[model samples]
Target: MAETDKFAVQPHADATSQQQAHSLEHWRSHTGRNDIITGLRAMHVWLALGWHDIRQRYRRSVLGPFWFTLTTLVMVGVLGFMYSELLGQEISDYLPYLGIGMVVWQFISTAANEGCNAMIGAGSTIKQIRMPLTTHVCRMVWRNLVILLHSLPVVVLLMVFFGHSLTLEFLLLVPGLLILMLNAVWSGIVFGILCARYRDVMPIIGNLFQVGFFLTPVMWRASDLKERAWIADINPFNHLIEIIRAPILGTPIMLEPWLWSLALIFLGFAAAHYLMVRFRERVAYWL
Candidate 1:
């Protein structure tokens, strides 16, 4: 009788363990499927919000949306001339480099700064509606991309005036831009979620970026820092800028920097995805 009771208790415990394993697997599958569907639905809403944001941004301006293009041109012209003299390079060669770096930096900075507040900026909408939190972050990225698009004409004009002959290599910009945009999306998601939870993050990020401007090779060429060449190698932004600028300037893309940038981008995306999944529900409350 004692042996039979022990055998019975053993099977009961085994059965309970099996049941728990099944329950956990089911929960994982259900959550995974929900996140996918939610992300797809959120993408659609993001598109609409992006358009609305662009319109709203330009609604009251006298020159309207063209102001983006105008301002970018003015800033690029001023900086290109100043940096060309400082770097002791011909205006023709140096201006293209400056223009490309400045243009890419604008996009990166806009994404980072705005991404920090993406969720908080949409607080009214988040509060009033039932929507996926990712939508707000995606919308912020899309809106900044639209602004970047508007500023492309300035790039074209600068290239026309200061660039070497155009080549098929220019097509490389497509992939480079895509990668940069993906990085933006990932960064936005991570910063948006974190900043929502920690309000103090915004000011800190702003100050850091201000300092980053000096450290990055925007106005100066990497060649100028012969002793500190490691700085460009370590700075992900430097790699990203080079990926776009090299091909446009008809130079071969350096493999090391490109590979490093890809690794950083992959890591960024993976981390953001994990955070988004883990804190999916809590984001609403944080906002």
Candidate 2:
């Protein structure tokens, strides 16, 4: 009886120590010091994963990655020309607008769609090891960015072909890209957690993105909307695109759009942070 009692107590004691160690490690990882290290580590992992994703996407294809560039150029060219003619606008100016808008929209749409599955997609890894959840989100962002970079050549070609003068204002796209990336991080955290809990969210988000694509001023100019210009004002995506488009066109970033984006950024980060904190422990089980 004494020996059995001792054995039971020893197992409980060992279990307690293991739990304490796990709790300590979790807290350490959450602290700023560990977060910084984790962030840097995540960046490296993300880059490698992004490259793998890009390669796998076009593996064995004759055209390879260039297919992404070619498809984008052809689609943008055909849509821009068709829309310009239908809207009775000059092809030269409208083509650039269409090209930039489509490229930016591609980033936004990809973030929204893929972001929902960031965590769930990594279920096996999450179960096998202890890794920072943010790493998966960062991977999604990096992968999308790889696609964005591939499409950039089209933007340059459009500028050259349309005879648009590149100015210092075009540098605004640097900040614009930053904003989009921040948005991607926020979306990845929020949607990734949510969809991990509720699998149905993935399909719902996909449908919403399809609807958002047409609603956004991707293939058309804001000016063409005319009386319905308020649509652009209400759509956060429009502001996001404008952050890139206005500067590229030598137009100033409107104060309202910047204000709206700032507000969304703040709100998005706050929401994601809260969700991550509250649900971090349950994520693996949910997945």
Candidate 3:
């Protein structure tokens, strides 16, 4: 009878161990880090989806994505000419500066603008599918990156036409682009959550972007604010643009902008991680 009791107790202990392991798995699965890791691992899904979005959007159009290249050229030509004249800057010097800034700003602004809808726009899939919610945000950022690439040829042409030779500093654009994309990811998660919960915030973001364009020194030079340099120094967008723009224009890369950009990355990810973990499960319902 004692032997029988021992065998029964052994099964009970095994059951309890299994239950504990299951609980541990569940806890880890619910973490934000897990979500990010799983989402990144599912890159094939987001990559295909991002490319599909671009192809579908320009499906019937003849020029397709090259339209971005043409638009960049016209925008730079028209604005570069007018702004250079009005600001009393030489055209040769100003065009390359304006072109690089415009291209970089387009990526930053477009990623941000679309990021607001990252979760909301994928509403149907979110409800029906059980994937990491961050996947949608990654898709949004990747789509904007594609657009950024399409517009890059304009930057190359501008540098060539304006006689800005490639220097070792031009390689700085690689890391600058990476940092920009990382910032976009966190911003997408944060803004995506806020806009999903508060629909009205979307239009507010749009308006802010319009004002930000003029305020951020995209068209205007930061050096023009000589006496009151604090204005540009205070704008985070200015630092973001400077990181990429300075590299392309072969200007001295300032350590301050790099510091600010890195600081923003850490702070932004902290906020994003909190919101993601807190609301990851509820995002589908919010959609």
Candidate 4:
């Protein structure tokens, strides 16, 4: 009788263990989705945090954030003329193009470079608070966006100086900007999580962006590539840059860049979502 009872109890214990394992897996998956949704819904939290960052960065300064605008103006003026001469492109044509490209590239590159520190920088908060991890990533992206707004004056000045008239096609910037921000968000989440886990990854990401700056057509034109235009065509950054730059310059916007950006948006978010699901809980411990 005792032997038979022991065998029966063993099977019951095994069943309970399996059920608990399944429950744990389900909670992890649910928590992942909840983290993102909750972070997005708590925009008030991240918005205030983002705004605070911008203000703190320029606190007590006379020009405040406009200093960023002045720097961008200087870059556009100097690099625009220098690259124009080096590449033999007409100054009238090149200045506005470089202006918009530099503004857009500044936004993209800064968002990505700072994204590597998003989670790691928030290590103290993550350890003490139970809020969604995505909030930190959102805050970093928003802070950069505020800086981008300050830099828009540079774009406005370019349009006026170059005598470029706005057309109905300028509305294209609406969708282009939306796509760019979405990409920034996902890329930040992925980079933030990875950088928090592995300290070395941040430098590698920085180096890649540095190399990308030259390879990308920020100071030069894709048309300069001439017969080898396909080189620029294949670069993802080229497509991303052209989406906004072309509209600003009043050049014909192509369908190819729109399609490529949409694809990148989808693929990037999918990767970010998977990483969030798998590693969301691990992030706090990693920090």
Candidate 5:
């Protein structure tokens, strides 16, 4: 009787171990792509929200979103002349360069800063609705993109006045913009979760942005740094900005910028997907 009982218990223990292994495999299998798919399906909802976000912000203002245009022009005018003289650079060449760099930087900075609040800003909605949280990040990106478009006239005006011509190189901007947008989306998702989990992270991000602005090559040219050019070479932000700015300026895009940008795009989305798979469920409670 004892020998028979021992054999029967061995089979039961094996079965329990197999069942536990299957459960663990299933839990680890989720790739988080579902969040992206669901958000895309609900495009109308987020697109409209994005549009409404713009309208609501400027609702009471007469100039509306044109304020972005006005502000950009003023900065270009003041900084353009000041930097041209200060750097002993030609105003014609320098102004257009500064304008393009500044505008692209504005788009990037605004998108990233807003990304930190992608989830927290929608705290009420996240707590109440069952919508995919990625949608909120999408909304923030679209809103900033629209504002960037409005600021383009400043770039165009500077180019035309400075005698820069559009060449076939302009086509490179499309791929560059697409890459930047992808970066923005994934970056927003990552920062959104971190900010929601620890409110302290947002202030740290702000300080980092201030440092990044000075570190990036917007205010100065890569040639100015010469042997120290590796500073820009290693900066992923500089590469993304250059991809767009070089095309706008009708200059050739460097091989290094493209390499760094493509590599970053792959890494950024992969990391974001991993974060979503792990912590997405906990976001609501953390809020």
Candidate 6:
């Protein structure tokens, strides 16, 4: 009777130890860790995939990714001409504004839209393999950035046509681009997870971007809203657009826009990081 009782006690102790070990690991993986190291380590793999995505997208096309540039160029020209006449703004004044705005806007809009589908789109891969899930978001953001690079010639052409010279201020665009790119990373993760769990969110966000096009000052000037100036000031989209656009056009970068852009990035990255650490392992199941 004594030997049997000892045997039972030992097994119970061993079982509890095993369970505790597992719980420790489970909590460790789910503790909403705040770190960039994992994402940084996975960068090489996502960079390759991002390049592949661009190539795969335009594989057979004659112009390749420049197709986007041409399409954007046409849109800028048509809109710039028509809107300039209607708004009584100079063609010279409007063309560069619209050109830069549209190109950067494409990057912002698509990065956000693709973010919603990043995890879902990579659903098969996520299920079949074990990997850092943020890689998907990284790849999507990089791919959009590649598209933005392809559209740069359009901006250059617009600047040439408008007889605008690149200024010391043009260098400001580098930081602005980096800031938006940072937002893209967080947007991809946040939207990817949310859309994976609730598929309806994807389309809802798509429609919002469509409405946002009108609300955002992508093609329009904020001066048009002089009486309602606070509207542009309050609109996050306008500030985001300004960060990139003001640099390209050699205009003053407002303190308000810079403050807003930084705030969005800081908050966005914090939220995305928490969601990633908490839900990353569950993304496959959500998909």
lDDT of 5 by residue, 38-103 (tens): 564556878999999999999999999899989988998899899999999998889888887888
Candidate 4 local lDDT, 1-287, one digit each (tens): 99999999999999999997985564334477677766766688899999999889999999998998899989888987898899888888888888888888888999998999999899999888777888888898888878887886578667767687877778898888888887888899999989989989999998998999888888877877899888888888888888888777778879999999999988998888899899988998998
Clash pairs, model 3 backbone = none
Q: Ten-residue segment with the worst summed lDDT in candidate 5?
A: 23-32
What 10-residue stretch in candidate 2 is worst by lDDT?
31-40
Q: Which regions of candidate 2 deviate over 4 angstroms?
A: 1-28, 31-41
TM of each candidate vs. truth: 0.83, 0.85, 0.88, 0.87, 0.87, 0.86
- Model 2 gets an lDDT of 0.82
Best by TM-score: 3
Looking at model 3, residue 286 earns an lDDT score of 83
* Candidate 4 ranges with C-alpha deviation above 4 Å: 1-30
> Which rank order by lDDT, best down to worst?
3, 4, 5, 6, 2, 1
Tens digits of per-residue lDDT, candidate 2, 1-287, equal 99999998998999999997986586345732243236435566778887888788888999777777788889888998899999898988888888888888988888888899899899998788777777788888988887887787578678777888877887888887888888888888889999999999999999998999888888876777899988877989999888888888777667887787778889998888788668877889997
Full-model lDDT, candidate 4: 0.85
Query: What ranking of all candidate models by TM-score puts the best one first?
Result: 3, 4, 5, 6, 2, 1
For all predictions, the C-alpha RMSD in Å is: 11.6, 9.7, 7.8, 11.5, 12.2, 10.4
Residue pairs of candidate 2 with colliding backbone atoms = none
* Residue ranges of candidate 1 with Cα displaced over 4 Å: 1-43, 60-62
**Please, what are the lDDT tens digits per residue for candidate 1 over residues 228-279?**
8788768888888888888778887678767877897889878777886788
State the lDDT at 233 in candidate 4.
85
Q: Can you write out model 6's per-residue Cα lDDT over 33-73, one digit (the tens) per residue?
A: 63244654567778999999989998988999888888998
| Tens digits of lDDT, candidate 3, 1-287 | 99999998999999999997985565346556567656756678789999999999999999998898789889999998999989999999888888888988888888888999998999998788677777888898998888888887677776777676878898999899889988998898889999999899899988999999989888888889899878999999999999988888788889999999999999998998898788888787787
Worst 10 residues of 3 by lDDT: 24-33
- Per-candidate local distance difference test: 0.78, 0.82, 0.86, 0.85, 0.84, 0.83
